[model samples]
Target: MSDDRSPSTPPAAEALTRCDALVLGAGQAGGPLARALTDAGRRVVLVEATHVGGTCVNEGCTPTKTMIASARVAHLARRAGEYGVHAGKVHVDFPAVQARKDEVVAQFRSGNEQGLTEAGVEVVMGRARFTGPHAVQVALPDGTHRAFEAPLVFINTGARPTWPDLPGLQDVDALDSTGLLGLKERPEKLLILGGGPVALEFAQAFARFGSDVTVLERGERLLEREDEDVAAALTEALTADGVTVLCGHQALEARRAEGGLSLRVRGPKGEKTLHGTHLLVAVGRTPNTDDLGLDAAGVEVDDHGHICVNDDLLTGVDGVYALGDVRGGPAYTHAAYDDYRIVRDALLHGTHRSWRDRLVPYTVFTDPELARIGLDEQGAHEQERPARVYTLPMSKVARATETGETRGLIRAVVEASTDRLLGATVLGAGGGELLSVLQVALHGGLTAADLREGIFSHPTWSEALNNLFMQDPVEVPGAQERNDPR
Candidate 1:
């Protein structure tokens, strides 16, 4: 099917304003697309439904990480006893923490707004709906509406938290990630309803903030998408921090309880009920594809409401593309950023940047952060390639021991016989930063020998990588030619 869908019958000026490029959703993807297009001397109009910097800067990463930092401080004060420091009666000001988070968000929000202005990109604050493949009608902040036309339309409308269809779930007054951020009062007892990154992160955060936290995961283990060891470490860390984790429990229903909320769950132990002062659901996200009129534009979305995009980020609709959470791959801030590069390159230079080849890394911003990139062991095995798993405990790293945070691991999955770096997972302090090196290794076509030969500074968190590769190896067929160690 042809992607371009500009209507042959044109309307008056009220219909559309022509531009070289029109971008939808001004978060990470839209903002960067606008700047790149503008820099390339193309007339660009950037439309945003809500704030700039998308969810990462506004809601997801920025605010959440800011909250995580507060939790870390609270945790440190509580742990001061081990260092011979008697920090008696520690108290956390929830209002102050929220205030600080707001301050940080506002400062960055203004900077993002200023950047777009400085770049001379037209920023339209409104909700945009597709009129045709290349036509859009936007509802402005005021009651009035405006329309625009372009040869190319890029959709980057980010995703939002989804409420699962559980019985009595709608009756209870609860919070999602977005709603949790707006909470003024600290919950006395909080019940988290998922075991993914967001759920576990919030669980640990609230626990450190003095809330009795309980996490309910439908899977047999936490972070079901991650490797088993990574999940186990996270579960142990959360349990140690006073957060009760209940895995393999399916939340059947939720209801209002005596001054709290109760969730009925079913598992091997049969039916069980969990009670808490507040309920926070971090199950997953739903892409904001609805009401955009994708059907009107001839773009296709899956059952989960994700836009069907190609490897080059092209949607079913011609001259229109989708990226980020809507594209149905990894939903990360940097993934969205990389999508911006792909779309911009295709638009400006006629170059094709395939996201498939690039190594996408993900990190959970918990106390002992968890980061992973490339393929896991199960992925490698499914691909029918012999994979080797290597791991080094965080306690073996001098820096981690010195920091008194030695309770995680660095794992690598190598393409056996070839010794090429396939994937790496780091779960501990600085895991986010450490994952970048692995991304480089994967993208740069480096081997395990390269990692081993590299000079990582002494007594550093990064040095864990060198030791991680020193673990056991696996055998892959036809890998002798590529087995030369660096």
Candidate 2:
């Protein structure tokens, strides 16, 4: 039979929804943007192919952090004697932990859905593809199709785990971040094939859960984006927790072992086969722009499949924009939400708010946590910017000594001429929270002297900044110090 459906024609009026704004994905950006646009008395349609809240709420932050908390509790319980409390045999109930994580995820997802419904935004559960510059054809869940048209459209489809085309990798069973989170049973031995933030975080969590974990990283160190000292500190922390880290190693092949899975790895020591009960591939993430029909809409994507957006988050197509992980740049949920704000300001208020030169801060939820803001010591040196470097061991922080969590250190890079805080890294307990102090200070154009002499409360992690900035400048190799203001 000849096909009767015409691809160019728009759907009938009854089967099409025309709105002032259309949001492609109900992710971090889409959800809030949809609500804001709807509240502004504009008809908005928000479509989500999967669950709401995107990666942060569903698979990435909420679920993983919930389980990580449970793992932390288990670790603390085992270390009860260190705190002068005699707590016997700490047991980890894997199923119970998974259940709690599920509960948390469901609650957050439900809350997001309810909020969208209450905001008078039309929430469509379907996959969206651009049929024209200003129109999309949605494959609805009910085995039906609908078309949506709007002058303003926002794409926030986010990203997914990138599966590399390594030989035998696809044949053997491997878990990504999402699959690892859904695990109900504790793996006896876990083999992770990356040393980035996600890989290290999961490595620590699983190790604390009593799993013999080994991390194989292709780069020279874990968290390669950070300075070498920072990466070494994290490596030390992980090693102290019984994680076998193999840096400068590449996964040559994967095969089914007798009991579990076997990974052939090649490093400086030569090829070695590692066996594990579970294998997790936490290499990286790729934007979900493959099936978006971006070409039809005249929206361009970069080499990595990330939608190319201008500084204002525009996708080159008029009234169309990209946000969050799908638009590349910083793949944090906060960055995505900020993209929404930038777009909102441009479209709603007609203001030109650029998404450039903004300070981006992030944290890795390891045992002591690793948090950073702005440039690192290496970045300053590479840029040939003269700066004063300061390093303070966690042992110097009273809170770290008292808490017995002094495994990491704090490092700060400050411009010598201006005394302005160029960057800071907090690697001790509550590092993410403590990094915020420096973040605020830097954002307000505060200098190292300001932080050094600030009256910070004693016996707290934040107080470490006082000692960090007070230390005399240490000359780093290949770094020329500008004239010190002091």
Candidate 3:
């Protein structure tokens, strides 16, 4: 007997390619889930509107981090004298840096495409929208149309940078996070709007690249989601690097100016006009649900435009699910990857997994990376959960002093009665890498004592965890201490 099955091909125009499952948006979730379903002997059709590897590979993580790495190297080279290395004057090659970032993005995207192709998943390039509850219509990239029907449909269309509706802002040329990554020439002066992680990361990276960067945040402080001390530390760090931070300021208008653009901003003091060679709006991201035809599929979205889903990531309609930024919980690539696992287990393994109460870890790739897992000091207080908070300055860490990177601090929040680790924030050098140590401990249900008493390597950043957990709970100046009910 001869086998009749051949490799999957793109759907013909005006044709319908029926499959057991249809995965939309080749993001962190969709791509992985497609491969998983295929490996489990299920027919899967994965459709991507733009590029493969979704936002993380094409724009968010892969490309941004590659540029961030270049900026870090440039920064370190400039500081080589502190390390007793006579490194000559360092100059940033902006074009080369952009080229390297492009190379990395291409390599990642190619790998994702190859993986899906080899997995026997039918890959289609198109903008997909639901024609009905179980049927989807695609406008293919080649100006062709195709339809698909599947019992199980997953939407992972990810998010895009949000442009604020400031007056005259749209008329003037500005760079979003995506646009910033593609710049071949470094701006002489960069004015950033937004104090969030994305905004701060770009601010620092451009500053390190020798741009006179200024961050104009409407919020009262940077990283407002974090504790006040964390915000202060980050502000100080950015300031030390010569980045002017203007918090509690709003951009009222924008216009073309000599040599660049000018923004009129309103601050506590008064109104001021700021000029810059470039403007970056890193305010936030909105989900890609508007064009997905959710109404036809009976899928619900919240006021913020994120698809409404249950704890298991299922949409309102049966057999239809949403994951990643589209579903809108944590907008991290790892969160989306975890969402895939939850869906896979529920669909194939007969095991139910929920996103409820799951611990998500995130890192900001600044000079001294800011990494956090679980609740921070403010979260504990806001929830009114009785917790003990221990704060340790990086100055106390031997490795930090030896490396001349004693600029940040480490804070751990633990359950007062059970001694369980609740959360931690690491803001020193290698903070992101070091947060994993506590993440593993948290996953294993280890107490703060476990981390404090564990034998850590000598003169290393991980060893700082020992001192962080062992120290007495320092009294936060304006924070009230609550008694544990237990």
Candidate 4:
């Protein structure tokens, strides 16, 4: 008798194709989540309108770091004479530096694309708008429409530079951060508006690259988010770098000047004109949530257009999630990566750790990188916690002395009674690397005594923390004796 289910019979292979997850805006978070889900035996569809890698790779961090490296080399070559080295005359070839940056970006983009393809994630290059809670309509390049439906949908469209509502500024033809990085030719002079990390970084970079740089801020000081002393130190560094920084200059109007652009800025004294070959507007960034039909999908957005996400990274709509810059948290790549973990756990495992468990650390990649993690003095004070502040100048650090980069300080804020590490600030050559120690101390729940007791390698910049915590409390002038530095 011939059996239907024989060994030679073809197996059940032709199953219906449907995705378990659909991720929009393939950036750091979305791209990795897609790969992780696919590895967990879930079918994933990752969609991107532009390149596979998002802004950070294509136009943000990668390009900025490349340009900064070029600037750093140029800076060192200029100062080689002071180090007892006879270096030849140096000239900055702007076009050549830009070309090198473009080469690096292109290689990274190609790698991102190749990785996505190899991961078996369907990378649809088109603008996708949510047509329903579980459905997305993608506008393909060939003028065709493709509808994808998945039970789990993730939005990670990231952010763009926000243009403010200053009158006539929109028609002034100014450049944002993205446009400024793509310039093949360097301007003779540049006028930058705002005093955040982007503004400060670009100001120093352009000045080093031989452009007469001027930064105009509406606030009372530069880098207002940092401590007053930290901002003052940075201001001094920028002034020494030949950047004409004008704080409290509220930009009123922008118009064409003699062969350039003129900005009418108002301050306490009066209105004055600031001229430049080009204007770089680095006010802030806004989430790219608009035009994506998030409202139709029942996803709630804050007043600033950022998607409202819970601690679990879930949107108001079930099975819909938002992460990265779109979620309106610390807009850093590492934070986005952590967000990926939270979403991945919620989707793949039974674990229930919230994104709030991660303490965010930030670093502004300047000459002396400004890095911070945990709460600062202000944050601790606001929480009504009795705090103690300690700081060590880089000039006293053995490593910084040997490296000739002793131009900053390391500061820590700790609870007086509990000794729990509250926050830290480091401004020095290895500020980025130094932040890791503070991050571990904050997240690992290590106290001041714990850090002071730890055996760190000698002659390292990080020894500053150990030295800082070992110091005696501030001495009272009238009632107490002076205590020496440990």
Candidate 5:
């Protein structure tokens, strides 16, 4: 399973190989799917152009979160005096942080490849293109082509970073998420272009690492998918961390300026030019289906190149399925893993549920982390659903007071009819963990009343949940003015 894709001379002719399953892109889903297919008594061939563990391991979550952890340590070190503990001046070794991230990624990726090898799954390192329905041609880095045809084909090619269409974009070198992680030296000032999870996470992390960071969000507000309160609190948190946030800003052009790169942007204020040492385009990602020749395989893709699939993850083609981020849903690793589970159950057990039933919990790796599951207050109102909202600032949480990390809020949405949990958002320290507690409650169909009466350990973040449900639900939007604050 040790694949080296170094370029070499091309082979004379291509040869075709037949297998029971041909999975494209050894990403979160494809990696496990290949192994499980082999275990199910089907021969599997996994084609990956790069690392086995996809973006999470190679570029996305693993590397970024690892660096975020280092950034967190640096942040805490600077804030040590808040706890009545004196600390010396802190300095960050950027290379050392990068090394640790690289090490963890290597371990995870190597383990993925090793598992595939042990499971008897053949691994091919190359670019895959569908030659026909249930058939693919892979061009290896050595200028050689290998072909695979299988009754069962899975598309898990994932995605790549896409830069916005701005003038002079190509003329100046701009870093995508992958390129940002590969920086040998931290930029004196980092200009981030986007307001999504990816953009904000890096914005906070790099700023904590002592870089001058500014985030330009085209939307009128950051985290457009979130409620105004949640987004505003995050904005305040980042501002307190010394990161400048400009909302309603559109980059009109990019160009080379003295000492580095420059962006000509139009904001709510007016047209202005900003200079920075590096530019990171974190606007969005495009699925890798562009060159996959999906048309040859009768697979359909959305306007954004995301493969469209049904609840069963089938692409409306016989024996072909699409999963993970490529399938056009929540682009989280857990969702991708569940996709493998769904597909595996259909393939093996012949029993599966609608994909819509799954819960997608996500966390922004920012300080006083932001975590969410199910719906939010705004979403419930948008659907005109009968739901009640409850909110508690982190300052009220006992553990938060004890830890001196109270710069966020906790919010919950409950079904007014059922009294059961509809969704929740936590924007404080250990927010992700808090989200997990709510996730279990939502999964168990526990009512907010149940949580309100539920006893929890004192002076703990989990205990804050008990207090979260103590307050009366905010008046339904449009009923009257509400007192709930972010």
Candidate 6:
């Protein structure tokens, strides 16, 4: 990270290119912001070190989900007998899957590049360093330096995978999320080093693709942020998919093995040796802010290296703003785009929309997806907000029962006093898609009774809501469902 360096001195004046705005990285937020700034008749310069699209198209969402789709086909083929289809034995073509993923990624990246070209955004392919509050110098590919000076500078370099601090881990050639996406050979036995969404999603996908996958989570449970029941349901689904999920386990050390890789782990029982063809460390990611010499611009970053920003996404420095994963909270592609919108309106329309209190919904791309929005049961308890929890097994949903994909649950929390919907978690097939219904209801201020009494088309997941909200509410402590709406 640039934070480790001394303050940057200004670049040569003759080589500088002045622009109305400078975007540091062509990530989710920075790419769109660059074009938008150009549309506003402002000369925009977009500096990208590698690909046109950031983690999303190049590594994270696009490539991974494409392979997940391939894995889903293998999973379905194995279960074809249940659907009365006589499909042959399922086998994954690892190279073919990689090719498809690469093709999709290339198309997305080219689209972004084409758009930037049409919009006349001057793109300097280089690593960016802040020389001052309004000045940035780029170390170009051909050993030349290019500098940009703008009144407004946006940082959107996003984040990358962080390695865990286990002894010998770095020496072992373990894969990060990006590296895993590009692996040439499928692991015969895969070991995952985290319990978060990245670990869980990839665990299920590779397991379905025929890898003997083991997940070692340091916490007592996977998705420690989610409610116990919700996390348990997801863990069960992954286990049923043939993934060995070991919670409360920490990697003591890692080393290169005879055939692949070896990890020594400790659990409640005792220390054990786990062997795998590959290891993926999906613990988390840190911002790219550290290497940009933010201190030179007087831009503050949190202890974790995330750039500090206010409700308006404005940094401490007046002309500088940080967007997307670099700004820290809610590191999702959609959230990053919304950051663009916030700053877009503020600068172009003079309307400073806030970053606080935004509804961030996310889905884990597993067989039976885990989608969540707003507060969960534990959150209500922590906030000491009165709430009523209602849970329905997927077995109870007609669609789930009919499809024979009844492996998860849908849980909702409603404000006990007013019976208004607060949050919902969907953990079933197409759960991510189903979550939009709950999101819409919450966004529209719909109540439990409203959904319970509402009519939905027959045998659809949406129709399950009629019975979901009709269930007897589990009254949480200090919370009771009331007949009064107000």
The window of 10 residues in a row where model 6 has the poorest summed lDDT is: 477-486
Total backbone collisions, model 1:
3
Which portions of model 2 show Cα errors greater than 4 Å? 2-14, 476-486
lDDT of each: 0.86, 0.88, 0.89, 0.84, 0.89, 0.90
| Model 6 global lDDT (CA atoms, 0 to 1) | 0.90
TM for every model, in the order presented, reads 0.92, 0.96, 0.95, 0.92, 0.95, 0.96
Better of 3 and 6 by lDDT: 6
> Per-residue alpha-carbon lDDT of model 1 for 208-238, expressed as tens digits?
9999999998889888778787788888999
- Number of clashing pairs per prediction, in order: 3, 0, 0, 0, 0, 4
Per-residue lDDT for 1-486 in model 2, tens only?
764656545455527778999999999899999999998999999989999989999999898899889988998898899999999998898999999999999999999999999999999999998988899999878867889999999999999998877778877789999999988799999999888889999999999999999999998888878989888888998998899999999999999888788999899989999999889999999999998888789999989999888888987999898999998888888888888898888878999878887888999999889999987888987786778899999988899889888888898888877889889998988899989988999989999888888888887888888888778876543333334444
List candidate 6 stretches off by more than 4 Å.
1-7, 10-14, 479-486
For 112-156, candidate 3 gives per-residue lDDT tens digits of 999999999999998988888888988877777788999999999
The prediction achieving the highest lDDT against the true structure is 6
Give the lowest summed-lDDT range of ten residues in model 2.
Answer: 477-486
TM-score of 1: 0.92
Q: In candidate 6, which residue pairs get closer than 3 Å at backbone N, Cα or C atoms, i.e. clash?
A: 1-290, 1-291, 2-290, 2-291
Model 2 lDDT at residue 11: 51
Model 4: per-residue Cα lDDT over 1-486, one tens digit each = 853743222224422225899999888899999988888888888889888789889988889989999998998899898789878998999999999999999998888888877888878888888877887777679865577788899999999998877766766679999999989888789999998988888889899999999999999998777888888887887888888989998999889778789898998799998888899999999899887877568889999999987889998899999989998889998888889988888778877778776678999988889999887765665565567877888888889888888888888888776788878999989798998988888888899888888888887876777788877633112111123333
Which ten-residue region of model 5 has the weakest summed lDDT? 3-12
At residue 105, give the lDDT of candidate 5: 93
| Model 6 TM-score on a 0 to 1 scale | 0.96
Task: Give the local distance difference test score of model 2.
Answer: 0.88
